[model samples]
Target: MPSFTVVTTAQRYEAIVETGALARLSEFLPSPAAKVFVVTTEDVWQLHGSTVASALSGRSWHRLLFPGGEARKRLSSVEALAEEMVSLGGDRSSIVVAFGGGIVNDLGGFLAAIFMRGVPVVQVPTTLLAQVDAAVGGKTGANLTSGKNLVGAFHQPLVVLTDPSVLHTLPEREYRAGLFEVIKHGIIASEPLFRLMQLERPSVLARDPAAMQQMIAESVRIKSEVVSADEKEGGLRRILNFGHTVGHAFEAETSYTRFLHGEAVGLGMKAAAHLSRLTGRLDAPTCQDILDVVDAYGPFPTLDGIQTENLFARLVNDKKSILGRVHFVLATRIGATEVAAGLAPELIREAIASTLR
Candidate 1:
């Protein structure tokens, strides 16, 4: 297994990226373990339940089904899962296995954070998006009516297991859409990672094991480095939200039903790249390069009928906003970014207008 260690003030854990990580779950579980709660959605359970069951055969465990979707990412779900855990005779020693995609990882991690005042969670992310981003970061939360991830905690997982082979089961659009996040890693820190995605679309889209592992491993390294430096999103971590500000607005306006999170992020990146150019932080050629990768990744759902003004206004509610000024991570070049606050309203207007229409 190819692994990286993430160290934070609160905890340290390994993120393992390998072809058969599912078989290795037992190896990473806490020794002298008590009960285990496997939190996952029915769809994922149906596909991989047997594999997981076999791997954890000797352990005492119960499967907790989460109706997975952005709409279901709520405090209600967290509470319901907790209630289930208590009914199952769970206690502080009972560990949670968050075994699903990004949404379940976030929801389950939050569940473990609060259940018995924070039991351990081992994240086994099943989707491409979850593998590269959500699984590695200890940031766990659910959506709020006011904004995305408004209520959450920095409860690190005991470990994270990412098996790239599982991505073969992902839907075509979903798998490709998730690349926007991998692209985010590249743009924020590594030009080579960006170039790999840019140049290897065919191999990546084909799910070539080499291409997939390389993309996933490198993404984990970047995420581990960033999270290790700033676990709480207090400073350097803000760059991880490179395209999320505008992207989240699209999700809210559509009520989280229309686009996958990454699809919305793809649009958000377009707007951010344009904003970078408009702000004179990034040159035209570089801006176009960023735009080209976003466009290449997308025929993102048409932004028509969705008001850019509404999207622009939604920025104030972004968790990144302080008082009312939206802080944006602007690309100075591929593999580099600078955080900017209090962007001019006039420029914000143009950035949204340019991509959202």
Candidate 2:
């Protein structure tokens, strides 16, 4: 029953984090809806749908399975899911229960935002990455061939329910990928949190319930505060995109198949740290400290053949970039970051070359 509220100018929503919280889904979705659409992947449904089904036995609901993986996160998928919802009698009163990892949350949230001129959504995040990052933020959208999340809306969910127990079924690599966000949270705002990860890396990876719960709560709190203050990525919120500038570029260059989102961000952080040192924004010791934490999460996917120039091409296409200027988020030190604007492409290229080597 550990819960917190994300307060925004538009509305405030609650996020519940606990073991076995999925069983209490009814409590959150109390109002009767025309229909409840559970949007998830086939593999996830096969593994955990029954539990969710049993919990919603008294309610009228149907499950919609989308193809898993980043490849399927497209406008086509959103159109297909919306068509299915309409076929299933979904309307403005329908509820979309996003029930998987980040992809599911992003797609479901986007679907909810557009279906019947917008509907409500509840995020039941199953992966650590989703629980701590994607599930909380109201950011939702499908990726275009040009860039990630190029077409999306800032539609907030009604509630976010995280059951840490579902994380037990996650593969080790996936779990490790999720930790990159937790590490990012620490680097941006919580030194003690960063130190805790350094001290208890083994226990955290083992998914010790107590450690996991605390880590998830803390990460959510940090993000909740940031999102509350800057709901639309106008100002302070850009800090959350610490590793995303280059990270999104890497994903686009590789076609989102080579590395997980968090894995790419992990590499992006390494590059950002190098740029931070090269620009004298962060000292050598702090830069190494950042790299040490990132290395602990490795061995990360290498960018052996990917050209730095190609990465810069993708980087400029990022939605955050504007009018030929890239708003690069660089670390000032552990627990702090600053957005460097008008950075030349060559400097970013140098940083990428330095880190990827």
Candidate 3:
């Protein structure tokens, strides 16, 4: 096994990712003395919660199940979870185990960060997106009527346990949605990882457990390295948001129902790539190269006509925007990325249009 480490001031922990880590979460958590609670989606609970409970068969465990999807990452759910923990006699020593995908991890992490001012939290990420992105960084938040992840806080995890075997349960579209992040990590950081992704056959990504583990581990390493250098998203940390600017807007415009995070990001990256090419920062071939990788996974729905206009309006409201100008994350080339602010709205509209074609 290749020993990898991402050292950061934000307390870090090793992830023993394998087929059965969910059952072993009790051992991975701090101790049985601490008041423990789990927050997960009903779907995830039905699929693997019992096995996880069985793992801690001899211990006391509290669970709160919520509806699945980005829609549930809200203040109401957080409020409910806070009440749940409080009713369980939770104190400062309590811990919230996030036991689902990004929505659960983000909300649970934020809840753990704020409830009782602060408490330790464990992340048992069951999806590829959570294993690589959401679970690694301390950044946690929820959506609002204005935008997605508009309400959130930054609270690091006590530990992140990744079980690749759980990924097998992901729907085909969901699994393909996560590949966008795997491609993004390579685009922003490691050249070797990028090349490996380019050479991967569909069968390998779909069926090879060892390959899946390595992919998740390497993607986590990229995000962890960046987060370690700038824990609070100062300077170099923003590079991780390469495709998120427009990605979030696409998510919000659809009310987060049409596309998953990765799928929206896949389209957003293509828009960013087109902007790069139009602005002469990247060659036409580079734009096509980015599209090739994104298109390889699955067909993304078109965002055209009035929806395109609406997405641009949503961008204006994005937290990253300032003084009515949007800060767009674009690429200088296939393996390079750049951020530009005060971009013309007309140009932004044009970029969004290109993706639909």
- Candidate with maximal lDDT: 1
- Which residue segments of model 2 deviate by more than 4 Å? 344-347
In lDDT terms, how accurate is model 1? 0.90
TM-scores for every candidate against the unseen true structure: 0.95, 0.94, 0.90
- TM-score, cand. 1 vs. native: 0.95
Q: How accurate locally, in lDDT, is each candidate?
A: 0.90, 0.87, 0.79
Candidate 2 yields a Cα-based lDDT of: 0.87
On residues 139-210, what C-alpha lDDT tens digit does candidate 3 reach at each position? 888878766787788787877888888988888777888888988887777666666667784654665887
Ranking by TM-score: 1, 2, 3
- Sum up the clashes in candidate 1: 0
Model 2: lDDT of residue 81: 95
Ranking by lDDT: 1, 2, 3
The pairs that clash in candidate 3 are: 141-152
Q: Write the per-residue lDDT of candidate 1 for residues 1-357, one digit (tens) a residue.
A: 699999998898999999989987888888656899999999999988888999898898999999998778999999999999999999999989999999999999999999989999999999999998998879899988776687989889999999898888998888987899999999999999999988988898889999999999999999999999988888998889999889888887898878888988888888899999999999999888888888887777766789878988888887668888898889999999999998899999899999865
